[model samples]
Target: MNTSHQTATVSSKDGATPPAPRTRRRRNVAVVAALTGILGAMGTLVYFAVPLYQLFCQVTGFGGTTQVAAKAPGAVPGRVVTVRFDTNVARDMPWQFSPPAPVEVRLGEERLVAFAAQNTGNEPMLGTATFNVTPFKVARYFNKIECFCFTEQLLMPGERKEFPVTFFVDPAIADDPNAGDVTAITLSYTFYNKGAAALDEYLNRSRATAGRAVPREMNQ
Candidate 1:
């Protein structure tokens, strides 16, 4: 009887120990799964953070990003400020670019500025422009109504085209203490070739159109 009791007790203890390891394994698996889910979520957020931040800057004019407006500021101020224009082109882009000399205008007064571009390349090309305003702090107050930077430009070889930018400084800028010392603002632009894909698409369309058209001799 004593031997039987001892065997029974040992059997009970062995059975209890087996369940404990299984429970521990289950807990460990749950922890690993939870950690993996958290890391994946973080990676997704990081991927989307950049474009979201840029949109926020463009909308709020934070970080010296300028604003786009449909119309000029309604009120004009007596204060006069000088606006200087700057232009640049990428080394790979075969184009001559020029900006007009500086001009002075009253705050909230609309001014139209022109930039000239000529294609020096032997082939027709498409280009796009990017622009920004400086004294970075003044970007929020510098408003552009219309600008060529809004569109892509196509120029044939030896072709020259003039682009215009209409803009004004918000009269409310004077209310900001940080802008008190600001006297001059510079608008700068740089042009780059659009891309091979755009050029190829244009060429393909031209070829397709030519194929469908009847030659003048055939029509006659």
Candidate 2:
């Protein structure tokens, strides 16, 4: 009887259960939570990053804006008129502008205008420009087919470059009562320097050394 009792006590002690199953469940839950959090963060980043970057580029002129360069096909031909080109850079930007010699073109024929931009300051300046027809109404008939302002320009100090724009007035304008009477159109350019964040410190230092005031138009 004593031996049987001792045997029974030893059996009970050896039967102590381990917590292996519970531990495994807790570890699995933790891993799943971690994965969920990481995926959520990645998704959130993707959602906001692209659009924010695009908006920043547009406002800062890091990426050039879309502009129409050519007139619509099949426009009516009208009397030739002389057009003028004007360019304005920010005051802080050290640059020079030269207007193209005026030329006469018929209403439907394409005309090309040229301008010379020179970096007068000591530092390299990088900027983008956009062109528009003044008086807004004339824009309907004035068409530009090729323009350098469509892209960003990197000008080294003392560098001079001639940019050309080819454009024409839509012949159709001659038929429209609102546009038919218009004889002259003005093409204007507004330029801005890329923000410091988009430009490197070396370039920024160059711009500062140049010590030019920001241009009035770029203040907008």
Candidate 3:
């Protein structure tokens, strides 16, 4: 009987696993899978971080970003506000951009502003403009009706063109406690070149044409 009991004890020690240990291992696996899935989702969010943030800013005017509207506000207010214009070009873009100076208008009144762009490059170039308002706190109250920024611009060598932007300050801005003290808003634009490939193609064509020119010996 003693020998039989000894054999049973050895069998239990060698062949039997505690149910609690098996359960703990399964729980650990589930937790690891859950963490992996959460990390994957986080990675996807990080991948689209820039564009998603931009869209959020556009929708909510979270930054100094302004709003785009289909029409002007319903009523023009008696309060007058000054809008100053500013312009810039990206370093690689071979174009000149200019916006008119300041103008004052009643709040909720639609105003038309023009900007001039000239392509000083030897080849055709394309550009896209982005704009923002200063004193970012009031940006949500600014609305754009028609803006050249909605489209890409293409200009030939030495070509100059004027682009128009129509916009207004929402009348509700006067009522907003945060924006009541604002008197002037600066509208700024920066143009980015969108035609690098076009410029390269133009250069290649010019080089090919030059290769066919009369040799110096022939001219002599």
Candidate 4:
């Protein structure tokens, strides 16, 4: 009887030990599976992050996109006239701006107006611009055929660069009776730093505060 009891206890202990190994094996497998899943997710995210960001940029115009400004309610196209270009920097910004002495063209003709942008600031400035027409209402009639504002300008201290823009007024505006008598159109430009990180932060902050996404292609 003593032998039989001892034999039964040993058998129970042995059975318990086997189960422990199986449990350990299952735990190990689970750990490996979890780790694999995490790594795969990370790899997928890394692969798609850049392209997703670019798509976001294209859709939001975060960089810049062509846009038409506000137009006069009753504006009609008039005789094709040359629209002039000019630029100005804030007092703190040591920059120089010069547009063509006399930018001229017929109403429907596209002309490239050139400007000399000089960085007079002591520090290097990354320049990006947002432009709008002086008379907001004429934007519908005034069209930019080519513009440098679509790209960023990296200016070193004391750097001078020539920026040009090709634009025209819609001749159809002259014929539109609703368009009020429009004489001169002025295109205005505002410059900002083109640093992507800074721009992203600024935009994000603006969106948070305003509760609206800032137009990415606003100035361009």
Candidate 5:
């Protein structure tokens, strides 16, 4: 006599019931929906990159973004702070920018400093500057009364101009325990060309559609 045995395939080795076809279908749909949502959020992220970065810096005084003020309150005795200057020009800017040499000032003492720029290119160009201060924690106390940054600067070929900034360190900085060790700050500016003739339109629309193209929940 010959004996034969067959091994049967079960849904699971442990004998747990398999999910029904409908249940499996629902899981597949959920997985696809999650992937779709993630892809959509990635697309929206690029749109918010630039403006969001600037806003974050400005709000938290991160990245050394400085503040604007009308004038210094008054000079504080025995509170002299060293302020260094730095300048940079974008490769395509075709302009020269050199901040004045470093200077020392008493807290709350209003001081005027000039940053000069000259067009080195043979053609007219429009350039603007972006500035920040370091240590970033001191940015709140570093106020600028006049600045050339963030403005449409038009220069004819070989044209030279002097832009000045009236600024001061607020005496209140002395009261902040976190800033007690801050004795110096460096103010730096970088100039770049945003193209010609469209400066106004570019700036006007830079933040115009900030929230329009992005959904409220995508960032969350």
Candidate 6:
């Protein structure tokens, strides 16, 4: 061999270092394990996404889910807010659902509202109601002490029932920056066939589990 070629050859003891095959294999295994963990976590999230999202909305009033209260803090002395109502019956429900007319309510004052429902079908049917408020952000301050929507109703043919909703605008709404300019809120409800809205009924169970009050937001 030529002298120049011999000098060009590098050995580990002379500071020439090569990558370790074992080290490379260990790195690959670590990367695969990390990737697998990440994918598994994402899959788990996808599976629980729906119930979790609804639970989140119910707690935060996001998506117009209103607050549930045991009683109204005394209505703001002279403050009044206009509340309008809307109602709907799902297709093929065979029921007539109507909400009360717009009414002026004093902040912190308890008010009783009623909705009329009649079963026109030939057979008795069970229905449940889903409700929301608009200007959706105002939902948190709209408190319902008691509402028929909280339970399922069974109506027999030709039976007419009046559903009661007892509620109030939390006096704190007047103090909230987000609700400062809110002069009116429309409460809406849609009656659905119990089987078609089995998912929505979960909110009721969650409410019961959460008890009298639910925090507005959650980290999870």
Measured by lDDT, the strongest candidate is 1
Give the Å shift of residue 172 in candidate 5: 0.6
Q: Choose the strongest candidate by TM-score.
A: 1
lDDT of 2: 0.76
What TM-score would every model get versus the actual structure?
Answer: 0.62, 0.56, 0.58, 0.51, 0.60, 0.58
Q: Give the Cα-based TM-score of candidate 5 against the true structure.
A: 0.60
Q: Which tens-of-lDDT digit does each residue in 170-215 have in candidate 6? A: 8888788988889999999999878635534555665777864455
Tens digits of per-residue lDDT for model 5, 1-220? 1222221244345577768999999999999999999998997888898999999887787887764476689888997899999999998877888789889999999999998999988987778889999999989888888888888787789999999989999899999999999888999999889785565565457556765557754866
Off by over 4 Å in 2: 1-78, 201-220
Candidate 5: deviation at residue 157, Å?
0.7
State model 1's lDDT. 0.88
RMSD score of candidate 6 (Å)? 11.8
Query: Per-residue lDDT of 68-114 in model 1, one digit per residue for the tens?
Result: 68788654757888999999998789999999899998988889989
What lDDT tens digits, residue by residue, belong to model 4 across residues 1-220? Answer: 9999998899898885435878889999999999999999999999999998778776676866535433323323445454666676655566787767656555666666777888886776667777888677777777776677746676778999988776767767666766657677788776666665754665567568666434544545
Clashing pairs in 5: none
Off by over 4 Å in 5: 1-67, 197-220
Q: Which ten residues in a row have the lowest lDDT in candidate 4?
A: 68-77
Question: Of the candidates numbered 1 and 5, which has the greater TM-score value?
Answer: 1
Candidate 3 has a TM-score of 0.58
Per-residue lDDT for 1-220 in model 3, tens only?
9999998898798997545888999999999999999999999999999999999999897997765677776657478889999999999888989888799988888888899999998878878888899899998888888888736788889999999889888898988998988999999999998768855766677688887675854788
RMSD from true fold, candidate 2: 13.7
Give the Å error, residue 134, model 5.
0.6
Instruction: Write down the TM-score for model 1.
Output: 0.62
Q: Backbone clashes per model, in order?
A: 0, 14, 0, 14, 0, 3
User: By TM-score, highest first, what's the ranking?
Assistant: 1, 5, 3, 6, 2, 4
Estimate, for each residue in 140-205, the C-alpha lDDT of model 2 and write its tens digit: 677778877746677888999988888887776667787656677788887778755645765676
Error of 6 at 197 (Å): 13
